[model samples]
Target chain A: MRATTIHAPGDIRLSDVPDPALSAPTDAIVKVVAGAICGSDLWPYRGAKAITSGATVGHECVGVVEEIGGEVRDFRPGDFVIVPFVHCDNTCAHCRAGVQSACVNAGHTRSGQGEYAVVTQADGSLVKTRGVPHADLVPSLLTLTDVMATGWHAAVSAGVRPGSTAVVVGDGAVGLCAVIAAARMGAEKVVVLSRHEPRQQLARAFGATHVVADRGDAAISAVEEITDGIGADAVLECVGTAEALTTARRAARPGAIVGYVGAGHGVEMPVRPMFEKNVGLVGGMAPVRRYLPDLLDLVLEGAIDPGRVFDLTLPLDKVAEGYRAMHERRAIKVLLQP
Target chain B: MRATTIHAPGDIRLSDVPDPALSAPTDAIVKVVAGAICGSDLWPYRGAKAITSGATVGHECVGVVEEIGGEVRDFRPGDFVIVPFVHCDNTCAHCRAGVQSACVNAGHTRSGQGEYAVVTQADGSLVKTRGVPHADLVPSLLTLTDVMATGWHAAVSAGVRPGSTAVVVGDGAVGLCAVIAAARMGAEKVVVLSRHEPRQQLARAFGATHVVADRGDAAISAVEEITDGIGADAVLECVGTAEALTTARRAARPGAIVGYVGAGHGVEMPVRPMFEKNVGLVGGMAPVRRYLPDLLDLVLEGAIDPGRVFDLTLPLDKVAEGYRAMHERRAIKVLLQP
Candidate 1:
């Protein structure tokens, strides 16, 4: 079976690899319907993250259950499902606490291994839709597996409440989706910090009340201006860069919460300033399994169209171009049809 | 009017200073009956935080209102009260949200410089006990002004739920009080990290089930071992040191919460590890005004004796010695009687 592999920096390719099979009683084999590149993928693509040669390279997807192991009970063949980026047993103490991202038996599912990927704790990891979604809706539903859940987590963690103001610190798919999440969560004002015109427009479409093509102090001032000089009630750090993290910190009002979902890169938690402002920082990887059902419902009900994040799409064999387009900022997210 | 003042590092003096008068329409002048040296005072005495010569330096006190401004309605002259370290107007949006520590008109109250100290937003910043209590109950009631409230905030922010496990990371008065707070919050197991014999005994008396002498990694391992490798459900960071902060972070289970009330020193937030573990960090200066009523009731009813934090007591003239003892770590907290 053909799978995507990253051999080195700037060297992602679609190559023949062994097809995955259910190796555990709780595992289910998923036939990839649509997969996409995530912001985290850029870490390995840019060589910032250590990667072995010919390593499998994807952790987001929506697919159909093709096979199941003996212990798998909830899902059956041909069922459309959104697989959470992290697999969890769901019954563990942590998973029961709605922190499935930190499930005791949590593991990541990678798509670059083959057409079939084994999802551990299959009963808990996959959320099935009412039926096989239309091909056009597949990309958006696929994102429910990661980016959408992540964006939702960012909003939820930041404590974006009804009639509150929220500032999103990145303009990527996650940030744009955060705008949507904040809106859905009842934030009266959603501001997206984006310099890119296309991304800013998309942000507005997703419910951003304002767009500031600014960074750092300018961004903070912009948010404060919009919030009557009080700063945002919540700030979502969607980018892991130091500047983005600092901006998120400074843009929040005293006692405001900063929800960071970005993988730590250049980000450094500025302790003193955060302490003085009494800002609450809460975040990490998205507990997608905890949010999947609610988000999937929103998608099915047409409340959100996160697939709009995929500005470009291509066949699975053209995964390299998808990676290139994302890396070069030509596409926010690139959907790949298998 | 006589007041205590810090002339420089290691130098404290009590001398006559101008009596404080109402500086704002909402302000009130209070004659302090009791003021205590907090762990934060050591920061300036140790030269970690610079202090201007002859600056008044106490922030925790219980006093008798000597005068009230025209705008003060809820409080009046001759009222015995616990003054929150930070003054806040309770009507502000932040205060309405129960974060009086970050109130729109928040400001600090200085000790040492008067027979009278100005309490800003008198009606909101000072919470009067039901009635003037006997002199013997003064110390415990005074503690509700800051340390007790702070410890309570720490436990509350850490999400100490019934049947949960909680770890208090500090041997200071706040940490000892946190043991009480955790137990009061119904935590099934209360663990305290303390090497000091007195503190450990105090922790045990306050309901800590386990006492560990180690710091950081060792302490975390101890907690994990106690919780069957799952870590504590809640952690309170009561010491504002880098090591204590790290220890609190490490001791919490994935997705558990840490309530930090420490006035940060050189502490650096470990963003990556915290993110990976999905820990939630929340806390800041305690909104004493928010917790005063309940804590005062607990104290008045003899349900808790948080003032036990003050192992030593001295008259106002011996303020220098009190500061010296606390600065040199000879006392956990010192109560100054005027």
Candidate 2:
């Protein structure tokens, strides 16, 4: 099977790789239907993260179950499922506490690693739709696997509530989706801080009451103005950059929560100011397993179309182009059909 | 009128100063019945925080209303009252939200500045006991003004629950009082990290179920061992040091809350670790005005004795010795009688 591989910085290529097969009793093999490029994938593609030559790349995907090991009970061959980026045995203590990202036995499952992917703890990790979703809905549903759930976690961790004001600091697909999640959670006013027109438009479609094309001080002031000079009740730091984190902190009101889900990029917490404002900081990786069911329901019920984040699409053979489009900021997200 | 003043890093003197008089329509003059040293006070006495010569020092006091301005209707002369270290109008939006420490019109009212101190917003800042209490209860009741309320804030912010395990970082008066507060809040197990014999004894007396003399890794191990390796449900960071903050962070279980009341000093938030563990950090200066009434009731009911923190007492003339004693680590706290 052909898969995308990163041999070095700026050197993404399509190459032949072994198809995955069930390696454990609880595992299931899935044929990739659709895979999406992630911001985190940029880490290794840019050589910022350690990526071995010919290493598998993508972690977000929607796939069809091809085979199940003896222990797999909830899913079988031909089932369409949304696979969370992190695989977890839903029965673990952390998973039971709704923190699936920290599940004791959690592991990363990437579609780009192999055309046929082995999903561990199949019963707990795969969320099966009522049936095979229409091909057009695949991209949106694929998001439930990672980006959408991450956005949901950002909003939930920030304690966004009805009548609350929220500021999402990132123009990435995750940030755009965060605007949607905050709105769904009943935030009275959702402010998206982004300069990219595509992301800003999606943010508006996702119910952002206002969009500010500014960074840091200007962005914070815009939120404060919208919140009657009180700043936002919640600030979602979707960008892992130091600048984005600072903007999130500056935009939150005293006693407000700042939910940061970005992979750290040398962002030093502004402790003194955070302390003065009594702001609570909470968030990390997306607990997609815990949120997949509800988000999938939202997608199925047409409550939100998070897949709108994908602006570019390509065949799996052109996966290099998909990564390039995202890296160059020409697309918010890229969908690759296998 | 006589008042305690700091002349230098190690010199505290009691001398005649102009008696405080109402400067604003909302002000009331209070004759201090008792005032105690606070952990923060040591910052200046030990030269960690600069002090101007002749500056009044103490911020925690219990006093009797001596005079009231024309606008002060709720408080009258001769009413015994508990004065929160910070005076708040209690009508600001922040105060309405129960964060009085951030009240828009809050100000520090310290007895060290003068014998008769002016308390702003007498109607909202002062909580009076129904009547004058016996002299023996003055010291204990006086604690409601600061340390006790701060301790309560720590426990409350930490989300202490019945049957929850609580870990307290710091062995100062606030930490000792936190043990009492956690117990009062119904935490099943309260572990206090204290290496000092006097503080450990005080912690036990205040209802700490376990006293660990370790810090960092050992302290975390001790707490995990006590909780069957699950970690504590709530952690109270009463020490402002970075080490204490890290210890507190390491002590809580996922989804647990860490309430920190320490005036943060050199505390660097380990953002990634905190995010990975799903820990909630909530803390800042305690909103004493919000907790003074309930803490006073607890003291009045004889359910807690917070004054045990004061290990030394002295007349106003020996104010220097009180500061010296605390700075020298010879006393946990000092009570001054004017």
Counted clashes in each candidate structure? 1, 1
**Residue lDDT tens for model 2, B180-279:** 9999999999999999999899999999999999877988899989988778889999988788888998998876788988887555676777777878
Clashing pairs in 2: B56-B112
Once fitted onto the true fold, the runs of candidate 2 whose alpha carbons sit more than 4 angstroms away are A112-114, B112-114
- B105-208, model 1: which lDDT tens digit per residue? 99888972245678989888888876687988988887787888999999988889999999999889898889999999999999999999988888998899
At residue A145, give the lDDT of candidate 2.
85
Candidate 1: the clashing residue pairs are: B4-B112
DockQ of each: 0.63, 0.55
RMSD for each of the candidates: 1.9, 1.9
TM-score of chain A, all candidates: 0.98, 0.97
- Tens digit of lDDT per residue, candidate 1, span A103-159? 988988887224767799999888998888887788789888889899999999899
Model 1 DockQ class: medium
